[model samples]
Target: MLDQVKDAAREIADARRKIAAMGPNFDEEILGATRALYAPLIRKPSAAVKVTADVAYGSDPRQKLDVYQPAGAAEHVLVYIPGGGFVAGDKNLDGVFYVNLGNYFASHGILTIVANYRLAPAHAWPAGAQDVAGAVAWARANAKSFGGDPARIVLFGQSAGSTHAATYLFDPTFHPAGQAGVAAGILMSGPYLFQGELRPNLKAYFGDDPSRYAERSPLTHVGKSRTPLLLSVAEYDPAFLAAPTYELARAVTLRDGKSPSVAYFAGHNHVSTVMSFGTPQDDVGARVREFIASVG
Candidate 1:
């Protein structure tokens, strides 16, 4: 059963990559197809709400977030940000992503919040993070209204979203001027060094400021406070990028002053990690749920 599940998972992952490699013209179609794939698995579950609210405008005037929840859920909330190299993505297009995530947590009887923030190029580094932070504050203040547990909230993200999560986890200033911070966090396949010198793709969004890069890189901020975190990277995520992910994990270890638990999924690549959510017998999903449940 496990082998069969993994095999089917591989096929779905292949489709996910082909579409992503095709670029924007195919985004909606790919996302739509992915949603169809997940439809059967995503039971209506419990309570569900789709709420659109304003985030920070961030130089760009129009900035907003879409929040999703399960029916009658208690406050063990999760704030999920989508990854598109901090440049592209929308909550509307994230239906499949959030559906699987929301359903998974909802099945565990936990309230999950999937939010949209400003993206890059148009918005940039602190903009995306700031928008998410505002959403977090909103969640904290009204968690009870959504039937969620404010104190048990978790910040979770993948790829670029993982970057945002890591940034917020490390920088006490970014979360809020004086907020207590989240209980725990999960970063999937995120690069910790962001000084704009090493990574070309990120330079455009973060700019070429050594100080800004160092300050924003979570690795540089480790040990400030030990937030229980899980760092999971796909074993086959383009060989070139694997080292940075491990380095980021090591940073977490060094900063927390302990070896944080790291989960490596064999045969899984970068795009596949997010695709595995809510799939029965999916190893990565199981690990994520375990982490979220443990945190709760």
Candidate 2:
């Protein structure tokens, strides 16, 4: 037993060293390695938790979601959106990814919803936000059936997912009847403000028009949003994302006359930050839990 513990520690240390060496770059190799290292460490949801998989929230097949229902009553419902750089991603990537996140949050008594949105090029701009709104509507209507409070739904997204959640939370154009239904929004490493040379993946969704980028950006409309926000950035995130994360925080502070909750995950890269959930090395999971509880 002692040897098994020692082996796990050594393996974790080795993985961290390799990831640290990769620095802040957004590399597929690093993402795959990070997922591989933590997948085994993620615990399966206990028998107390019930999972309803592949439920449709919208008409499109990509608009399906997975629900993680806790043992007893849940104070809040968290809708988690995964990142795929706008063009790709899913609710369950490689099976383990977001399933682990759902299990982790559900175990802590939060009814977790892992959702998939429409991808880019085929469906652009407001499509992602529209899917998010659909998912939120589903949660608000059906949360009580799963032992979750409908009024306390939290919107959470990572990377491109974050951008979609931010758009739904901030932009009045996407809001239903000009009302942001979420209790709070948690945006992790999202590109809130689109500026300068737009990447091909981003352009695929936002289109080739640079002039419309500002108006379409969530940052441009955040000033009018009164909903609470929790912003986070990974320590080893690519340089391009770092600016937008802090810029969004600054913009929110300027608008609200106070700073929102901000978290910096040290020693974590873009992918590892979300992948670390349910692992022993997880540093931000507790913060996320606290944020949800505080908001609730």
lDDT of 1: 0.66
| Tens-digit lDDT string for candidate 1 (26-66) | 23455456455555543343445444344442344435544
Worst 10 residues of 1 by lDDT: 22-31
- Give candidates' CA RMSD values in order: 5.1, 1.7
Model 2: CA > 4 A from native: 1-12
Worst 10 residues of 2 by lDDT: 7-16
Tens digits of per-residue lDDT for model 2 on 217-258? 999988879888889998889989878999999999888889
TM-score of each: 0.78, 0.95
Off by over 4 Å in 1: 1-62, 177-180, 195-200
